[model samples]
Target: MRMVPMAEADLDAVLAVQAACYPPAMQEAADVVRARLRASPDTVLVARDADGICAYLFAYPSRLGKVTPLGSRFTLPDRPDTLYLHDLAVAPRSAGQGVARRLTDAILARAGGLRHSALVSVQDSRRFWESLGYAAAAGDGVALATYPAGALYMARRLSA
Candidate 1:
């Protein structure tokens, strides 16, 4: 029903939504999730209704070409020029309700002067992201090897 900055108390609900939204292989451990929030509390957000948390977005500031390996802790960069959209998940019950779009819009609005927004698309989500202005980057497997075979590194230039 509403979006709010993620809080430590919201982790349990956030993890539950994440588990329901992603496959086992794609889920991050609770510690890693906590680390990411600690690293970028400003960018992480949660959408909750009277029932509980239904969606969440975990993003952070980072360099243009840097990649956060799947299932790893958030690695804060010294000077980040890009807003890395590390994870976005909506519970099955919340699907088709535009929760992702709202969260993404809020995050981008918060990006301020960041030059770009980037993310890795997994589970054949390229089309969904592409519709939001993201484009797949042509890169060697070596750079994206940490992801599942079909994953892609995608980016979108922001309008300053």
Candidate 2:
């Protein structure tokens, strides 16, 4: 699969992959996803192959120590110091194929000037983010409360 910017044409497939990867309660609506795409088009990406979109990563410019509550629309910080990796989902068919890693690396590559990167690890995926150099960070307890049980806010410093 190849990494590419997410386009409006890809929303259907993106939603499908998201549905396959997350439980109903965890999934964001199309409008919310569309708003995010509008807010930070450059940071959102999709992984596609001959079959179609196999994975996607939704990210946006944000401040360190900030948490985007589940289902909330993205808001670009006035002075972003970090890239917030809001969501990453790979189709069930593409699991164990390293698609998630490649997609994440692609996003991190675009974050060259940022001072840090952060994410909310859900569904017991903290170890996966840990392998990518993210560590659990102190987060707003109220903001974190929006997520399902066991969600963690993690961060890692990025070299400029």
Candidate 3:
């Protein structure tokens, strides 16, 4: 399999893989995704085998949004050096083969050598991130602001 940076031409295939992997409510709008690629294509990572694109992750170095202040429930720390993992999806056919993990490692490695930590909005895979050393921020509920959909906030420090 090959892990590569996203390109404009990859959008249709990436969108297909994402739709195949997520529910409608969670699937990103194709236009929004295309815009993100136009602005920051390198932020998205994809996995492809001989057949085609199988799994992918959409991430960007993001800031703590208008959530509660630090130390509040679900409040993320106010730090700019954080990588925000927006989405991680593996094709149903490719699930359970460590595709997500591999994609994550590739993205993190590309984040350069200057970052405080990486964060992700987690929904069904709390255990998965915890296994990777992520945990609920000190703050819990009120601090998290649901985007288009509600998801829990978790973070992991990139070990230097």
- The TM-scores of all predictions, comma-separated, are 0.95, 0.98, 0.79
Off by over 4 Å in 2: none
Candidate 1, 24-114: lDDT as tens digits: 8888899999999999999999998778899999999987877888888778788888899999999999999999999999999999799
**Candidate 3 structure lDDT:** 0.67
lDDT of 2 by residue, 1-160 (tens): 7999999889999999999989899999999999999999999999998899999999999999999989999988889999999999999999999999999999999995999999999999999999999999987778899999999999999999
- The better candidate by lDDT, 1 or 2, is 2
Q: List model 3 lDDT by residue over 1-160, tens digit each.
A: 8889887788888888878876676566777777655644666888998778888877665543333222222223345566667667888878888988899889888665435444545456878888877777642355444333446677777754
Model 2 scores worst on lDDT over the 10 consecutive residues at: 138-147
The count of backbone overlaps in candidate 1 is 0
Whole-model lDDT per candidate: 0.89, 0.94, 0.67
Ranking, lDDT, top scorer first: 2, 1, 3
Error of 1 at 48 (Å): 1.0
* True lDDT of residue 114, candidate 1: 92
Best by lDDT: 2
